[model samples]
Target: MIIIFIASLILFAFLYMVSRNKYDEFIEPLDEKEFKIKKIMPIGFWVMDKINYRYASKYDRNLLNKTAELNGGVYAHYYLRVHWANKITFELMLLMFLLFINGAMGKTDMELIIFSLLVMAVVAYALDKDLENKVSKRRLSMQIDFPDFLNTLTLLINAGMTVSGAWTRIVTDTKKSTPLYSELRNVMLEISNGKSEIGAYEEFAKRCRLPEVTKFVAVITQNLKKGNSELVDILKYQSKECWELRKHAAKRLGEEASSKALFPMMLMFFAVVLVVVTPAIAGLIGSV
Candidate 1:
């Protein structure tokens, strides 16, 4: 028990220092073949990349893209993100193995089985939660970028480019580095590979899975099917619509912020009340 407690403290302290200094993030990218894990546990992680490559290569391209996003599209490129995920899973499994063995040393068979299963369950949940968080953050960033995206598209359309032309122009010319832009770049790749404009837009809208993006896709598809004479007007309207949504979102955020402030405000109010009432109560007690 003491050993476990001491080990936990050391682990926590190391984690704190690593997080504060961002030690893991300091490592520069290396070729997968050349990548070597020179660390405490050599059991799982050293060959993780090769294993990840073999497994990742088996996934369909779309699934691979999603895996990349969940692993970490914001901080690292897709390949690097996959590599990171592989490494993380490997290290976690190795740690869990060591901890499980330590825990099972004096335990009966049933107890050991239950404890190992519980640890595995908790580790699985944590990994899923981390992936979900990363994916949500990516989508949130795309949602936030929508209004600006609309404005750019509207500008290009009003300047007399075809919707497809405007999309290509924006994808090529825009300097902003966001998930939306990254997705649009992929859309351009599809278009350049002989996919129809509508098909590419549909793919983009589907992948984004946001109502705002879906609405924009619907408008673009309708314009494409019915001839694009109203393209500029449609884009102008979308720009306005996106901006209105942004306003509503901002208002909700403010309300949430106000609600969060109430707890602190209540604490301060009670502290003031205690300060004012304490002396009177003391006087009464002294007189009694």
Candidate 2:
């Protein structure tokens, strides 16, 4: 076990040294704040680039690209590859650490091997789960912010502003930089850069990838096409509906928070019970 650990450690060091300079281009642009795995990214890139096997399937690629697009903007494709590489690289590092620990402890049981493998699997699953959670949080943020944007846009349009002008006003005047607002800013940017309004809105919907945003974009595009006279009324109705949805989302979040707290509360209750009863039981035992 010790020999294996030493050899593996040497090999990893060699790989890291050889690949660090080779993959600096890919690793340098990754922001540590946005990417938790940025530190291991050079070795990760090497693993992805040098490993001959196809680690990601077509379905995996599509799912990753979609998820990355939501989080990574224009660099979605690059990020998808980086994420996969980082996952595998991190798993390999963990496995090496386990090997070293086993060597040092002189415990080479089959159970330990199985446990190490399970840990690797758990880490892999956890990384993917974290990414999904980020996407979910982003969607929730956009959902929460959507109602205010709709109300503002409706007001501006009712006061005789064109939809484009109203959208620009709301986006420009807002100080909040939420996901919905950022996407709103993107749409205006595209339009200002010569994209058609309908096209820009469609792209915005794609980037957002939310049903609520999709419905809102559909209404706007329809208005642009057919010139809906009751656009303000329609927007007002949607805004009210979105506010209701936001309330429901908030309630659900509160319930989730309470449930999450329940386990700790249970533990504390048992601890207090033990503290209060243990001395009394000890006295009774002494008397007996």
Candidate 3:
């Protein structure tokens, strides 16, 4: 166990030395929350680059891109690389920690080694699952906010505003800093920075990856391309549909909250039972 620990430690130290500062300028600006274990990310990237590992398959790459797009189109590729790097770095770190613990405790058994490997595997799986959960949460948030945004846009357009003007107004005037609003703000920024209006909206839909947003973008793009006379009516109808989606999203959140509370409630119930039963049982024993 000590030998294994020393070898793994040396290997990681050497790898870190070789990979250190290789991508600092590129990685320093990443959000610590999204790109956790940030200190090891450069090393992970270096290892990935050296091994020429893009992803396991095209489907894997696509799957990652679907979630990565939420960050931004320009950074989609970076996030994909970082996602894999984070997973690799976390698993390697866990392996080293497990080996060190086993060595220090002087418990060098084959079963311990096997168990450590399983633990590392589970950690890797959980890390990947974390990314999926992040995307799910972002999606739910955007869904819950979409109906209000649609309604506001409909009002602005009805009040003698152009589609672009209404969009800019909504993004600029709104104070809520949510994922949906942030994406809307990005769309406005892109358009103002000389990106074509239709192109910006299309990118927004791709980033959102929601059916309602996609349909909304299609309607807007059609309006931009062919000048829809019924755009307001279409938006109002979509807004109603989004309200339904929002309700479902809210219900799902409530369900999740209840489920999370269930375990604690059960624990409290058990605690109360023990507290009430202990004195009675003790008195019975003393009397006997």
Cα lDDT for residue 173, candidate 3? 89
Candidate 2, residues 1-288, lDDT tens digits: the string is 888899988888887887778877788887788777676667777877777646478867765656664664567767677777788778878978999988988868888899889999999989888778778888888888888889889899999999999999988899888888988998899999999999999988888887878998999999999889888888899899999989987887889899999999999999999999999999999999
Stretches of candidate 2 exceeding 4 Å from the true structure: 52-59
RMSD of each: 8.4, 1.9, 2.2
In model 2, how many backbone clashes occur? 0
Instruction: Looking at model 3, report the run of 10 residues with the lowest lDDT sum.
Output: 61-70
- Model 3, 46-129: lDDT tens digits are 889999985769866765676565677677777778777777888788889998989998878888889988998898778777
Candidate 1 vs candidate 2: the lDDT winner is 2
Over 4 Å off in model 1, which ranges?
1-116, 247-288
- Measured against the true structure, the TM-scores of the candidates, in listed sequence, are 0.56, 0.93, 0.91
Q: Predictions ranked by lDDT, top down?
A: 3, 2, 1
